[model samples]
Target chain A: MKFNHRHVLSMEQFSAADIHAVLDTAENFLELNSREIKKVPTLRGRAVINFFFEPSTRTRTSFEIAGKRLSADMLNLSGSSSSVVKGESLVDTALTLRSMNPDIVVVRHSHAGAPHLMARHVGAHVINAGDGQHQHPTQGLLDLMTVRQRFGQIEGLKVAIVGDILHSRVARSDLIGFQKCGAEVWLCGPPTLLPPEFARFGARMTYNLEEALTGAHVIILLRVQAERMNSAFFPTAREYSQRYGLNSEKLKWARKDAVVMHPGPMNRGVEIDPSVADGAHSLILRQVENGVSVRAALMMMLLGGGDRPRGDA
Target chain B: MSAGVREPVQVMNRRDFGRALDRLAHEIVERNQGVENLALIGIRTGGAFLAERLQKQIGKIEGVKPLLGIIDITLYRDDFANGLSNPVMGPTEIDFSLAGKKVVLVDDVLFTGRTVRAAMDALMDHGRPTRVQLVVMCDRGHRELPIQPDYTGIVAQTTRSENVKVRMKELGEEDGVWIEPPRPRTLPVAVLPPPAKERSKRKK
Candidate 1:
């Protein structure tokens, strides 16, 4: 019943059962999330240091709030402000943080496998927030958690992940995570954005947004990589919206119960219409809210508990 | 099913269990004066079912159903460092507010009262109820915290070495109170019958 690994560095490290164990734990913690104080003394004296080598207000703040909610001693260390700004090597900065004797170090570096590299050098548990375009396990987890809460089941649901598929770590992580959860995933966007290799993870690729939207239970619109705004992904935001944007009319063809999701900081009118993003079916805010619980599940499992065996938990 | 399967010695039987809940429901209605602002919230799995049964009995008397909610105390336990390897969570549906409501909390068994402590903490976090009353099928005392149930269905005194399990038929099992003595190698549970036969069989 225990999650075998100490560090949660990759979704690749998980099986469907392991992911189920995590989602199960997160659902349990959802009660705490609903409370007024929204806190539990589960990790009272434990220290969770959020080391983000990438500038991220959203992910870092979510982890910070999750830690604080669990009554953990949380410390935030961003790359620009930390010793990394002084040219300290990744390993050096990790060892320095290790000397503080923290219980966990949640590392998010721009270089892929940076968190994995830090885990080897540090005694404390490491959770990968996001590393390069490799994997953002928690983001993927929070998204899945939101969908599961709304749909009651992830199995057999048609999840359409649209926009900038090639550059999205969220898409890659979701592809692996959702497929493992038994959902049929459809990768939708321009041909350049929707790479053929994504099919290796069991997602069907489609260039037609309308085809992906039809019969889909969940529509996940990725933030069009701002860098892609200049590249060959699409000609312009106007052209892209007319084709791939999840506008109100495009949403009409989706299942009545179908939901719109974005790993936010949305390009509102670009990838999604403001109407649909704020629409009753959108689970964007809930996805953000679930981040806390999913992160709490990860920290609790990694630090003191590794998925309770059979009973008592 | 085995032919002529004999019934094991139990603290309470199906009919007695049903009668106890009916009595508890009457006690709740009488004590609360009426179901005016009253609500029933069950701790998940065990308490939730008992709450439903209690609601049914109360409904028969009052002709009106009290608002019902659920609390899953899995994440709220104080003994996270001990046992709790694979903590399974259940649904907590409280569509109504606990604010200004007289809430009756229900559970199957009252052991160390740690679960009650967790449940109270979990419930308070949701919203402050004008009043909070506790109910349990069996009050098996071990008082780790200064907590007690208000409307007790049965007070079954158990030893520190025995487990009091309230198996319900709602889960397709039987309804009875079966006490379990400490196993040769008991898991971290304070008191639970020798791990079910198949579970302990695997250990062998």
Candidate 2:
């Protein structure tokens, strides 16, 4: 009930209390996910539509599974399959989907405010899956869940996000989301990819990866997002790996219990070493697992009973 | 329980609550024939605490402990779309398998029979038990489903307008049951009774 947002557009909309409410709800779903019979009849008659204007495997499949586990009728629409390929406008597409009467809409788009635009046109609760360098709210929430589960708290913890901050929507969401939860956020990458203006976002910007990794509780390595970048930001992949990539040696710079994380489609050897990606300290896979639960919690709150008037009253 | 109106008529004091559970425990042992493969699974929040107490009472009587579990039936409720104002979820902990076991589902109150229905559905999803029984501390009935408690502690005849409040020691309230009478006609109705026709149909 504390999380009474009509739509999950960005982490900016979530206050510290709202974030905690979501993470607490997600804890229940995490237990459900561990069950032998994971399916629940919470959203039996409701319909959820996943409209991805961009290509995705982990996020798309995660949402699909989350919806199905709740017994919701799930419809997946990809860029190649939808009439957007036939020249339909985003608003027109949203209106077209609106006619089908979905209860919730999960959207991912290449445009920055595409989810916002969809939210404007549709009555269904709109959740931003990801928008072009704008936000990936659920990803931010799942990362928060992972960190909270590991550290048992988020306040006063040092979270270092490494790699291409310029084009990564995950970075933007994590920066705002983590800071909202009272975590010290540090951004590290090459100077071109990590700008000085990022300091205005209340995060400590660093060109030297060691400075960011030192004494950090969480180290999140971001994907390069080459598709979002038109020109080269770094000279070579080898040079970037040698300098910024988190290997066994680089991992030692953090606290003894420091955990490594990645918003995946991980270029195994680029932003992070494969050993670290598959290491005991890695929460990358846990992030994916928590993704399903966090998303399910969001859908349940928005559609189930978060806004229902008290029948007893 | 919703706040505001007062004048609580005490139905069962703390001593009566203890005595009812004692009798309910005896009946359960007699019916189930010495707690062989028996499991007590309580519905969350209220029933969960009752289940734990029942487990202790049953253990004291039989000289053995029955399997215990706690279930949150929020996810399986019939009115997920509207009935509950804020659905706060709890953990459904059933560590042992329910197969071939005589499971007794416990709750604090039995109202519309909908919570029992939801609990049964949730129980099935965990695993099918050989036999399942219902137990309630209070059966203030307005039966909407074809369900009845196998072992009941207190059966109070309550009006549709009156709300039954079961305060337990676990929740920092003295163990007792109180009936809250309907609000005055000048104020808007708090808990509305079901239509007369539906009530008659339920009785049938």
Candidate 3:
């Protein structure tokens, strides 16, 4: 289907076929990766804007790379670098950018569904990079794509997503994507972080790190938000790590070929042990690399071009 | 018989068609000297099946299995919203490592180059490959994007009013290529205005 001029707001809208389509396109993209000229003029005249309210080096760069590779003109506007510090409201900033007549906007905001709100005001297609703790759909998709690449499929694989769950948008999006792909999901964190009603999504909740890690084909380590400590949610980083950290010994309980993953920037010794992060089983870097491919695929599909014909709105 | 109706016709037979795949496979190996750092990724359905066959043929000639992957390219397609209902997703399989490897994009046909364009966008999610080359079973003439196939099994010159169909034995009963005329475009229904008396009564 034609993906041109579409807004990607959440994983809730994705179907199994949509997931398969993106993965299939990404495969063809891998084939195109060998040329000396790593760019195509598909979106040459199109303008894309990257509006990041939150601090992110990896996601922002991945979106920028995807735009540039497609030969689209990309503009990066971070809160610190933009007019937001100069007293520009989110809506005002969105309006100002909308006046520029961009073809697509990739937005990462501190508030949940900010991209959705921005979509209402702008004529360009909106991509939700991350909004508060609401959702990071692209990250979730890339994570799923990475897992699928390694495992050949996502059906019935036991996945343990450990660490901060309550305040993590990545966790929320990951849960949806993993479940949609037919994997059995488990949410493990401190009781305070793990919500009581997570069973609604068919995920098993746990406080014991050992039990959670056992027999899991994939172990997703979420970075513990240090700011959560200020609220007295957890006593200290060291204490939390001792109880929940994914150390080499703890990883032993997981499947032998279990792939370790984390959304960066990693806290090294906080959420996950250093040995495990750097271990042979770690697919952390692969996840980052896949982020670009997945984002590029998303941009292309959402922007325009695919198997299906463009619809008349 | 309607004034605008036309019949579809067979284009290429099995013997001539097998030669095309064989030639394309030879060209791929000749260009790369082997399939060592290269990968073959096909679009879903037909392209994917073709990629698997090419991998087998290339393996026989070069003694190496080129890394194979299948892309659904649906969510990434530009016209995703045109359908009446939400599209169903399919399996995307790429088992080998994509890091720093040369990739060969395989497809059953190359028409407007839009599919290849979408494929490129999807490829970035996996990893950065060292290089990428386009390989198609049929390069039907109709250039919408600035894309050219590096290796083509058959370069068929056809009009925009004609459709090219490549059927593989794995997915279909017959392994052959067919050319068919395009279906007639339907006109949209025009909305009629309300009656003058009813419009005036509403205003009053």
**Under the 3 Å rule for N, CA and C atoms, how many clashes does model 3 have?**
49
Model 2's DockQ?
Answer: 0.40
lDDT by residue for model 2 (A216-290), tens: 999999987655334578888878889998999999999999999998898888888989999999988899999
lDDT of 3 at A182: 93
- Residue clash pairs of candidate 1: A307-B85, A308-B84, A308-B85, A308-B86, A309-B85, A309-B86, A313-B84
| DockQ metric for all predictions | 0.29, 0.40, 0.11
Candidate 3 chain B: worst 10 consecutive residues by lDDT?
A: B80-89
Model 1 chain A: weakest 10-residue lDDT segment is A304-313
Stretches of candidate 2 exceeding 4 Å from the true structure: A227-230, A306-313, B1-6, B183-204
Interface RMSD of each: 3.3, 2.3, 8.9
Q: Which runs of model 3 end up more than 4 angstroms from their true locations?
A: A1-5, A31-34, A305-313, B1-5, B10-181, B187-204
Model 2 chain A worst lDDT run, 10 consecutive residues: A304-313
Ranking by lDDT: 2, 1, 3
- Candidate 2's clash total is 0
Candidate 2: residue A222 Cα off by (Å): 0.2
Candidate 1 chain B lowest-lDDT run of ten: B1-10
- Model 3: CAPRI class: incorrect
Whole-model lDDT, model 3: 0.81
Q: Candidate 3: lDDT of A116? A: 85
Question: What digit string (tens of lDDT, one per residue) describes model 3 on residues A1-313?
Answer: 5333367888887886677677766655554455444675556767889989888888999899888887789998888999999998877887888788887789999999888888877767788999998899988988898899999999999999998898899999999989998998999999899998778988988999888888999999998876776687788998988998888988999999999999988888888888999999999998887787787777666555322211111
What's the CA error at residue A213 for candidate 3, in Å? 1.3
